[model samples]
Target: MILLQLLFSFLQVGLLSIGGGYAALPIIQNQVVDLNHWLTAREFGDIVTISQMTPGPIAINAATFVGTKIAGVPGAIVSTLGTVLPSFVIVLFLAWFYYKYRQLKSIKAVLKGLRPAVTALIAASGVSMIIACFWPDGAVSLNNLNIESFILFAGAFIVLRKFKAGPIKVMIACGLVALIISYI
Candidate 1:
């Protein structure tokens, strides 16, 4: 039953989250945190951080991690498949039609329109995740806040905004700062 739920939830996210892995974060968070009670919002955010630090898509990483937490190795396999299947199906179909309709103006126009819709979905997903982070239970309060996280978030934002350093450099600097802060 748990495996089935994991598969269905991930599959739904995989189907709808068209932009990229970050675009899927809110759906995963909603299912894992609010619907299933599989993990807390902080844990979900931790998963996102770890997913970003690691290789592969965030959605797949999340599926494996969350599934394992819920129902072990089999759950991971099922969840991972669920997350990938939609993309596989959609891409396969698109590839088939794209070669034949490559010059069709109507198809081209539809594709152009799709780009903005996908972007909007991605943006909406980001807003939802931000809301989840700040207001887990629909009420915003500083008491529920994680101070270290907010500090790190602020510092990272400032660094990224002011210095214009490459992302890798910023990640490295943040990692070192986190290590130093951990000991203090």
Candidate 2:
């Protein structure tokens, strides 16, 4: 029963979350925080933080974490599958259809239009994550702020933008900085 619930909950999120992991954050928050009461908003934010540090999409990591929290390994497995299944099915169908309609100019035009929309959605997700990092409750006040995180975020942004260093290097540098700061 718990596994089924986990599966369905994630399936709903997976089907509707068009943009990606960050896009799914609000849905996950509602499910885990408001509906099931499985975890608090702070815990969800922590999960998002850990998810960003790992490989793969944020949504999958979130489903695994929340599932494990709810019903252990089995729940994690179910939730992960549920989250991926829709994407698998949709992509397979679209690939086949696109191959069949390869010569259709209208189809190509539609896809071209879709590219920008998808990019926009992904960009929106990034903005959402940035907002979450600074203001988890949607409030931007200096009193309940994390200065270390702000410093790390600003430094990372500058390094990535100016130096054009690869993401792995940036992550490693950020991790080292965080580790050193933690001991201070």
**Candidate 1 lDDT tens digits, 112-169:** 9889999998899877776675565676677876566567667877988998878888
> Which segments of candidate 1 are over 4 A away from where they belong?
103-184
Error of 1 at 28 (Å): 0.9
**Highest-lDDT candidate:** 2
TM-score of each: 0.58, 0.64
Would you list the C-alpha lDDT of every candidate in the order shown?
0.85, 0.86
- The parts of candidate 2 lying over 4 Å away from their true place are 112-184
lDDT of 1 at 51: 89
The alpha-carbon deviation from the true structure for residue 101 of candidate 1, after best TM-score superposition, in angstroms, is 1.9
Worst 10 residues of 2 by lDDT: 136-145
